[model samples]
Target: MKIWSSEHIFENPWELVVRAQWRKYPNKFNQAVEGIDVVDRQIDSKGVLRSHRLLSTRWGIPDWATKIIGSDGVGHASEHSAVDPRNKTMELKTRNLTFCSKITIDEKLVYSPHPEDKNKTCLKQEAVINVKGVPLGSYIESFVCDHISKNASKGREAMDHVINTIKLETVELQKEAKHAMESINLNFDI
Candidate 1:
């Protein structure tokens, strides 16, 4: 079993960070993630929102790895998340559904307000990787860990791109709304 962890601080508030996280996929930076589907969602009695989502990804595994695993590198994972609005925190857990016998990856992520800066949000991410019944288990574990580290960086970039896109869309909506209001006023005056 291999454990990998990382921490990052985003210069945006917790709310925005959570929004960006939900919209992170289908961005330019993280193309490996091909699709996402919401399996279930509900607001609990405590007013916390819980959601389950399935992710479809093409990890682009090397030919050697594909041949060994007898797979074309397509993978699926299920993610469960809870959002506590009162606490301003979001927690997500994901596990692989593909190659369960040979390899398992469990990942957890938490997003919350930074301890010292309310304007910033902090993300804590960790992944546990286990490879079994494989000839090169340790080597494969190491390779997967390295690949995850690289993808983590790209994930952050994707979040940033999504956040900026949201901001630009908001600006455009405001402009359109203002123009519509002006047109309405001009028609009323005439």
Candidate 2:
């Protein structure tokens, strides 16, 4: 009924992070174990299947959070929209679930010329993700988290390589500039 999950961010070219979790259901569809009467099934404009979170509101919350926070707390909710394939004009509301766990990543890096020397380069950076404990539906969350973490790690590696390459290019440019000045016999006034 309960699951554990975690996510990590990687240092990469494009921003990326990975997450992992263990859950009972594989995805949104499997959440409803007991054969809930198929009230409806349809596709929306975007061509996505829509389904409701079958679990009762109470079961949706993680057992851990409830123990610490003591009920009376609202869980996180997600909404998805899909265009009805039958009508094409009407949109179906598919896949709405409440989760307790949450994670976010923030990356900010820049490469710029040094303030005093235009030819010199500088690298600035700050990146990380903050995650909080939350209830996830079965093993579904775990599967997704693992996949994301792997992708993020790869991205981080690529980004680090790019940063190094940029640094080398900056140094080469500075050297070329110096050589050009010497070839022109430019006299330094100061």
Candidate 3:
């Protein structure tokens, strides 16, 4: 088993960041994520929103993995997330369902408003890479770990890009609202 974790602080408020999370899919930054289908969504008794999604991703695996998982290079994962507005926290988990006979990837994320800075948010991400059905466990583990690590780096960059785009869009919307208010005020004064 290989473990990896990351921590990131976003300049945007937690609320905005969480809201933008829903729109992150289908963005240019997340090109590898081919599709997402909402399997279930509902607000629990505690008012926490819960959702399950089936995500399809197109990923290229290495030669050794290709032989084991197949050569077509496509994988699917199940994602589950919860939004707790009252607690100002969002939690998510993703697990690869394809090629389980060879390997499995389980990822979890916990997001919350920064304790010191209300305008910022903190994200803690962890992933467990489990390789199975191999006698040379150590050697295969190293290679699989390296691949997941590289893929994770790309995923982090893409997430940052998506967040920045959301921030820009928010700023533009604020500017438009300000202009509309000013125009309305001017017309009323005249």
Candidate 4:
């Protein structure tokens, strides 16, 4: 078993970060994630947005697993996400479904507002992996742990890009609103 953790501080607020997260996949920085199909989406009783998705992904792994397992390295992952605007937090969990017990991997992520800096958000990532079905389980687990750590950092960079895009859109909208307001003329009837 291997457990790994990573953290990043995003320049955007939690609200913007969470919005970016929902559209993070399939971006330029994360080409490993090929597709996502939403299985379920709804608002919980507490008004939190909950969603379940099937994700198809392929990433770098040791060549031996492909030979020993007799299967391609593509991974079909199940992902669940929850966004609680009231609590100003977002949580996501994902696990691999293809290998199951042979090479199981589970990841959890939490996004929250930074305590000291309201404009910044903190993303905490954690992953647990097990590869006991293979002869070199220990070595494989270590390799996977390292890969996950590196992936976490790349994921953060992708999210930052998403948030910046949102910010640009917001600025454009504000500009339009300001222009419209300037053109409006109020006439007094009385």
Each model's TM-score, in the order given?
A: 0.94, 0.29, 0.84, 0.89
List the candidate numbers ranked by TM-score, top first. Answer: 1, 4, 3, 2
Task: Give per-residue CA lDDT, model 2, range 137-190, as digits (tens).
Answer: 334445544543554354444444554555577799999999989977756643
Report residue 117 deviation for candidate 3 (angstroms): 2.0
Q: Least lDDT summed over 10 consecutive residues: which range in candidate 2?
A: 13-22
lDDT over C-alpha atoms for residue 97 of model 3:
86
Which has the greatest lDDT?
1
lDDT of 1 by residue, 1-190 (tens): 8999999999999999999999998878878889999999999999999999999999898899799868888899999999999999999999999988889999999999999999999999999999998888999899899989999999999888888888899899999999999999999999
Tens digit per residue, CA lDDT, model 4, 10-78: 887888898899889878876899889999999989999999999998865558958776667778999
Give the winner by TM-score. 1
The CA lDDT at 178 in model 1 is: 100
For model 2, what is the C-alpha lDDT against the true structure?
Answer: 0.38
Cα lDDT of model 3 overall?
0.83
